[model samples]
Target: MSEVQDSGGEKKKGKKIRAKKHSTHIDMTPMVDLAFLLLTFFLFTTTLSKPKAMPLIMPDVNEVPDPSKQTPVDDEDAMTIILSKNNRVFYYFGIKEPKVEQASFDATKPNSLRKVIIEKKKECESRLKVGGKTPNERHKVVILIKADKDAKYKNMVDVLDEMNINDVPVYAIVDITPKEIEMISGL
Candidate 1:
């Protein structure tokens, strides 16, 4: 808002009548109040986005482990993924003598890591008992993640992200044995 005020000064040297000088004043209190009001309005109306987190369930430390009574994962439903140096990924199904196969993280490739994860998950799900009506009732696919000492941390994170993106139910990060390191050393 603006207002015009009489300066209350008359020129003595002027021969003819002239317009009187007026000073202009602008009141900024209302503008400041309106800005604060809008700021508060927006602050009250909007909801902040929650942070994203990867869900990981760990076994209780107090529970005594019984190896014999533990549920055994079927060979068909078990997939082991290994992260190696230079962004190398290797995976093999089952615990028996594994035939390690190289995989790529590139989505554009035919044999991308994401595609492999999805395919393995489907394969495991297909073998589920027929009586189970829903995905929860069926057996979960077990994925074991192992990273070599020389493997980059980013590669491991990428592998975990792939597992999450593909919805692989049961995945665990395990220590890589020296033998496994030797297995991928040549690659």
Candidate 2:
């Protein structure tokens, strides 16, 4: 709101020869109401986006296998991927042991960890098909992800992304054993 007034000095002649001046006032109530309405509309209609998160299913600690009753995962059906420092990737077809072959990460070439995952999945499917197993009985390719203590978190994330891209059904992050560490250091 605003107002303007004129002083009585303009009639100093005392002849009263002046038109009456009106004080100018502007009502700001409507503008204030409009501003509040817009604020309320935006507050009610605007959507707050939620943050995205990757889905990770962790195994329970109590689910540890009993050595006597547990059946070992077949070497042909399991693939282990080792993540190390400098974004290096090493893999073997089975559990970590001496004489296991090593492979480096190669995004441009077809012979990458990604390729190994795909091939292993196909191989598992074919083996199940030949065995006259039903679809439900077919074995899914199991992937073991082992990260060295010196590896970057980014490298682990990249490997996880590769797992998702390759559609691996069963994969777990396992700690590298002493023997596996020695094998990596020797390489």
Q: TM-score per candidate, in order?
A: 0.65, 0.63
How do the residues 1-187 of candidate 2 rate in per-residue lDDT, one tens digit apiece?
A: 1222234444454544454367669999999999999999999998898776878887777987778986467666788788787777887775544355566467667667777778879888676634555877666788888998889987888888888898888888988988778777866
Score each candidate by Cα lDDT: 0.81, 0.76
Q: How big is the positional error of residue 95 in model 1, measured in Å on the Cα after superposition? A: 1.1
Cα RMSD of all models vs. native, in order, equals 10.8, 11.8
What are the per-residue Cα lDDT tens digits for candidate 1 across 54-173?
A: 666666668999999888887777888999877889988888877789999898798888888888887777665558777666666799999987789888778888877887878888
For this target, which candidate reaches the highest lDDT against the unseen true structure?
A: 1
Clashing pairs in 2: none
Clash number by candidate, in order: 0, 0
**Alpha-carbon RMSD, candidate 2:** 11.8
Against the true structure, whose TM-score is highest? 1
